[model samples]
Target chain A: MENFAALIYVISSVLFILALRGLSHPETARQGLNFGIAGMALAIFTTLLLPNVGGYFWIVIAIALGGGIGTVIANKIEMTALPQLMAAFHSLVGLSAVFVAAAAFHNPESFGIGTQDDIHLVSLIEMSIGLAIGAITFTGSLIAWGKLQGTISGKPVTFGGQHALNAALGVLLILLIIILCAGESAVIFWMIALLALSLGVLMIIPIGGADMPVIVSMLNSYSGWAAAGIGFTLHNNLLIITGALVGASGAILS
Target chain B: MSAVLIMAGGAAVSPLVFQLAIFVMAIFVGYYVVWSVTPALHTPLMAVTNAISSVIIVGAVIALGAADASGFSKFLAFLGVTLASVNIFGGFIITRRMLHMFKKKD
Candidate 1:
């Protein structure tokens, strides 16, 4: 069963890659979307069949509610508002990364990482980095969405020592990660998450609204990296591949 | 130090190393593939990528499926599922809409 699931994942990964390749020309872009949808469906189906997965009642409810909301918003939103919508969607991905990371942290054995007291060193590092990146992406994308929506000022918000403050925070974030890795402390983990959330807001507010497209794309990249980091924790290859693909795509587009 | 470096290099390769190799290569693939996309299709590209990135939902599904998931873990996973579902549906629909607009002119 595991082998079969792995085989399906490999095929789905290929389909995803092809889906991206199809985007090279408008003639095949829709075809690419179809490939992407099929790949996603296959990946999800196979994951559901994994030995580790159990109940599905709540899962169904969650997907139904989310899908309904997404469809309505997509249909009603003005094309002019697509950038902000993109920001909104990126924020969702970011938040999902954080949630999944937290879930895994809370139940390491369920994730096939070791138990709470003996989680693999690599897994610990992966979880911490994933949580941090996810937090940053979540808040950064939110601020970007607000700016694009005109709810926040379009003008650059600058302050004296802004770079210094950001620099200090960055260093502190790294220090916290190191501490978390060395000691495997949950407090340090949450601390990194909170600091990253703040850093995301601080990092984006300084840029003017005109630069929001770039910021949106950059956040898109961060979302992908966040996903990839969590993938490392789960030892999931498809996540790593798809995340890298999105990360690279966002970087290039930005 | 040199001996330690050499020994490390010669040690049996871990699965993480293999996954890292795949990750790095996929980045190159994405770089080339995305660059070939025409300027006119950038918005659709962003939308489509948004759909694909929701692949993270697989992680949520696994979390939800876990037999021993606590209420807190389940809640987190449930939120992950809901949020990712929004991206998957909204992203694809909007991308298709944008692409259709382009096709009308062509």
Candidate 2:
């Protein structure tokens, strides 16, 4: 059964790769849409075949509600607002990663990692990466969305010692990470997460309005990394592969 | 130190090395292929990437489907799944709508 699921995942992954290739050309691009949807459909179905699935009441509710909202918004949105819409979507991806990270931390035993005392340093690092990157992406994308929406100033906001502040925060985040890796401390973990979120806010606020497209792609890449981090935490190879594929490609596109 | 000794000292480098290899390969593939995309197709190309990245839904689905998921975990997973649904649905439909306009005969 596991092997069957793995086989489906492999085929789905290949289709995803092909779908990406098709996206690269104008003629093949529209034709490629079916492949992507088919790939996603197979992937979702494959997950349902897993032995340990619980009651899916919540999942079903989420899909219906989100699908309804998404369809309405997508059909109504103007082309001029696509950039912001994309940014807002990236924020969703980012927030999704954050939620996944929180879920993992909430219950390590279910993931087959270890008891509360036996957490591996590697997993801790992975979790922290998920936590920090997810938080950063969430807030960063929000700020980008805000800038695009004119709720936030589009001009580059500068102040005295801004670069210095970023540098300080960057260094402090690293220190906190090192400490967290050396030992299990929830307080320090949340602290690092907060700092990372702040870093995201600061990183985008200084970029001018003309560069929002670049920021959009950058956020896209960040969202991928956030997913990759969650993949590491969950010990899911497919997530790592898919997330890395998105992250690297998005970086190149940016 | 020899390679063996160095690996023994490393806590989690192998997974990273493998992951990095995949990342590099994807980057190269994307770089050439995406660049080859004529500027005429940039919008649709962007549309696809946006749609594909929301595969984060996979994680949320798995999380919410876990047998032992607690209340908090389920809630978060539900939120993740919901938002990711928004991304995929909005992204693909919008892409299709835009592409429809291009498909019409003059």
Candidate 3:
């Protein structure tokens, strides 16, 4: 069963790679979308077969509700509002990581996560990074979405010592991560998450209207990095590859 | 000694290194591929990528549907799937609309 799941994931990953190749060129972009749909469909079907899957009642409902809303938004949204929409989606990716992390935390055994004593430093680091980046992206994208949507000022928000403050917050997060490695510590974990979330907001607030395309692409990279972080935590190779592909492409576009 | 300890944890460390390598290389790959995109197609490109990002819906569905997944966890998972699907559906449909506009230019 495990082998079959892995095989299916591999095929899906290949399709995703081809999809990326197709999306890169205008001539083949439509074809690329087809590959993406096939990859996603295959991945979903294979996951459904997993022994761990349950509670289909809610899953079906969520898909219907979400898919319907998405269809409506797609048809109604203007071309100019696209950057905001992209940022909004990026937030979802970040929030999804947070959800996954919360789930794994509540039920570590299902994810093959061992007790604290047997935990490797690397895994802990990966979880923390994933959580932090995901949190950051979530909030940062929200602020960007707001700016693009005209709910907030489109001008760059700068004040005294902004850069210095961001740097300090970053260094503090590193310290918290080190402290977390000393033992199981939820307090420090939440602290790191909170600080990272703040940094995300602060980072995006300073960029003005003119640099939005760059900001959108940068958030795209951060979103990919967040996904990659989740991939490491889950020990999913395909996720790592896909996340890196998105991250790199977003960076390149920036 | 710490390096040796990291080596002892090579199995865990290796995945991180491998992912980092992929991340770094993908930047180059993405740069070349995305760089070649025409400016006129930028809107469509962004929309297409937006659709692609919905890939997270897969993970969300798994989490929500996973055996014995709790109510709150299921809720979060539900949220993820819904939001991601919105991105996917909205992104692709909009991209198609944008692409249709390109015909006027031609």
Candidate 4:
């Protein structure tokens, strides 16, 4: 059974790679998207058929609600705003990873707790990456939206010594990360999160309107990598591989 | 991680397959929705679309938060935020430019 699942997963991954390739050219982008969707649906169906899926009611509800809302938004949105919509979608992906991590953390026992303070490394990795990336993506997306909506100026938001400020923040985030790696440090996580948020703001602030597409592509890749990182943290071979593929292809497309 | 185990057990589908399916469906759904609703929106509807797209980023980030990952995973989360902001705002600018194209001299 696992082997079959793996095989399906592998094929799906290949499709994703191809879809991305197709997406690079506007002419084939639609077809690529179709292929990608088909692949994802297959994966989801397989997931639903898993043995321990006792909570069918909630799962169904979530699928229905999410799908309905998504459909409405997609149909109603305009082409002129396509770029913004794409950005928002990327942000959502990051947020999803974050939520997944949180859920996993709360259910450590279900994640397979070992004796003698057996910390689930995979779970920890998932939680850490999810939280950090999720937070950053949330703030960044908001800023992007604001800029698009003209609630905020599209001009790069920079001040004297801004680069230095970014450097300092980067160093701080790295330091916090080191602490978090050694053990669970909620404080470090909080600080690093703040730093990342500020960094996100600063990074976009300096970029001009012409660079939005590049920024969008970069972010998509980041979100993909974030998912893959979660997959790694959880020791989910499928997630890591798929996430990496998404990230790499997105980079190539950009 | 328990998360991995849970994922491993669930429906046993491949990520590639699932994501690809989602992507294709999104395009179709997006096209259909736009076709149906374009006439209903005012010319400035582009503004709303831009806003909606930004909101989607918020949704995606929220979703990622729901995931089970850490360290590098968290770092990657920032990528989405950065991208969404630029994308939505960039569109907003383009819309303004397009509008300018139609403006007659005072």
Candidate 5:
């Protein structure tokens, strides 16, 4: 039974790959989307059948709510707002990883903040990544949204000393990562979280409006890499493999 | 017997969903095909659809990755990202082509 599920998973992954290929052409994009969605549904079902997938009610509820909301948004949102939507997707990817990492960290087996368990390490890494990526994705996406919606100037945001500020923040984030590795610490976590959000804004704000598609693509790739990192934190072989596939493929295309 | 019942249920539902999905896909395929045939409105239509496609990715990633917090959830997150990447890449290629059409002297 498990083997069959695995087979379905593999097949679904292939479909996803093909769907993506087809999506590259406008003529075939809708069909590609349908294929991708169908593939995802299969993947989701396969995952749900795992032995550890406790409680049926929550899963069903989530599916209903998530799917319903998604359908409505897809049908209702205007074409001009699409870039903002893409930013929103990046933010969600980061948020998911962060939440999962938080949950795994708080699990009774680990030190809640810091410990040496492989799973905990994975969770922490994912959490840090999520915090950083999600924060940036949120703010950067908002900026992108503003630009697309005509609320903000479409010109790149820049200043004489901007790069220097980003460099200083980068150094601080690295130091914080090292500090978190040494012990279970809350202050350091908050510090890194702030730094990550700021980094996202800095990286994105300077990009020109004409480059919105490229920026969206680049952030999409970042989200994939962050997911792969979270997968590492979890020790789930499937997640690791899938995440790696996504990150690598997104980078290639972007 | 339990497995048989499960298989039967799967058989009953998957086909129906697949058919519906295909029908939905056909609408898009046909729309784009017709749009492409009309040189006058192609660029504007493509531009509009490109934006719609981007939002689809966002919605997919968020809906799939929300709140379940399982290993499966992580996998879904990755899937969401990949799907979005696909949408963006595909959308851009079409956009580039559309813009190129304007650049060339007609």
Candidate 6:
């Protein structure tokens, strides 16, 4: 069953690659979107069939709720709000990454990582980085969304010692990561999440309206890497491949 | 040192190593393919990629499916699913709308 699932995942990955390839030309872009939809559908179906999967009652409900809201928003949003919508979507991806990392950290063995008291060192590192990146992406995208929506000022917001503060936070985060490696502590984990969230806001606020598009794309890339970091923890190849593809796409566009 | 070299050269590479290799290669593939996209389609490209990136939903589903998931973990997983679903559905719908607009012009 595992092998069969892996085979299906492989086919889905190929379809995704073809989807991006198809997007290279205007004539084939719509076809590319179809391929992407097909790939996602196949991936979700295969995952549902995995041996470890449990009941689907809540999962169905969640999808319906979110899907219904998403459809309404997509149909109603103005074209002028495309950037804002992109930022909003990117923020959700980031938040989802953080949530998944937290879930895995709470139950490592179920994720095939390790037990709570003695999680694998590599897995721990991956989770920490994932959590950090996810937090950063989440808040950063939110700020970007606000800027695009004109809720936040479009001017570059800079204060005294901005770079120094950002650097200090960066060093502190690294220190926390090292401490986390020495011992697994939930407090430290949550602290990392909080600090990263602050750092995300600090990092984005300094950029002005003119550079918002670049920042948006950069956050898109960060979201991809956040997903990839969690992918490492989950040991899922499809996530890793898709994350890398998205990351690289955003990098090139930015 | 020689032993380390021999191990590195051996066929018994770890799964993580294989995953890293695939990850790196996929980046190159993405770089090339994304570069070829026309500027006219940039918005739609971003929209479609946004949709595809929600493939992270698989991870959320795994969390939801775990037998031993706690209430807190389950709640988090549920939120993850909802958020990703929004991206997947909203992203595709918007991209299709934009593409349709482009088609109408041609």
Candidate 5 structure, TM-score to reference: 0.63
Model 2 lDDT tens row, B17-91: 655555555556555656566665666666666777777787788778887778887888889889988888887
User: For this target, which candidate reaches the highest TM-score against the unseen true structure?
Assistant: 6
- The per-prediction tally of clashing pairs is 1, 0, 2, 81, 1, 0
Off by over 4 Å in 4: A1-3, A24-31, A112-118, A121-127, A185-194, B1-106
Candidate 4 per-residue C-alpha lDDT over A128-161 given as tens digits, one digit per residue, 9 for 90 to 100: 7656765566557656766776678888877899
Per model, how much of the real contact set is kept?
0.79, 0.61, 0.48, 0.01, 0.00, 0.68
| CA lDDT of each prediction against the hidden true structure | 0.88, 0.77, 0.73, 0.51, 0.51, 0.88
The C-alpha TM-scores of every prediction are 0.95, 0.90, 0.88, 0.65, 0.63, 0.96
Residue B13 lDDT in model 2? Answer: 70
- How high is the lDDT of residue A36 in model 2? 76
Best by DockQ: 1
Off by over 4 Å in 1: B1-11
Maximum-lDDT candidate: 1
Please give, for residues A59-121, the per-residue lDDT of candidate 3 as tens digits.
778777877887888788776777788788778778767766655544544556655345567
Q: In model 1 chain B, where is the ten-residue run with the lowest total lDDT?
A: B1-10
Tally clashes: model 3.
2
Clash pairs, candidate 1, are: A54-B65
Between candidates 2 and 5, the one scoring higher on DockQ is: 2
Model 2 Cα shift for residue A222 (angstroms): 1.6
Tens digits of per-residue lDDT for model 5 on A128-217? Answer: 664565456556766666666677888999999998999988888878877775664767766776777778778878988888766765
TM-score-sorted candidate list, best first:
6, 1, 2, 3, 4, 5
Per-residue CA lDDT of candidate 6, range A1-254, in tens? 87998889888888888888877788898899899899999999998899988779988887898899899999999988999899999999999999999888888877888898788888889888888998999999999999889999989999999999999999999999888878888888888999999999999999998788888888888888887888888998888888888889988878
Query: Model 1 over residues A97-196: C-alpha lDDT tens digits?
Result: 9899888887787889988767888998888888888889999989999999999998899999999999999999989988877887778877888999
Per-residue alpha-carbon lDDT of model 6 for B1-106, expressed as tens digits? 3544565788988878767777887788888888878988887888888888888889999899888888888899999999999999999999899989999999
The candidate with the higher lDDT, 3 or 6, is: 6
Which of candidates 1 and 3 reaches a greater TM-score?
Answer: 1
Candidate 3: pairs in clash = A52-B67, A54-B65
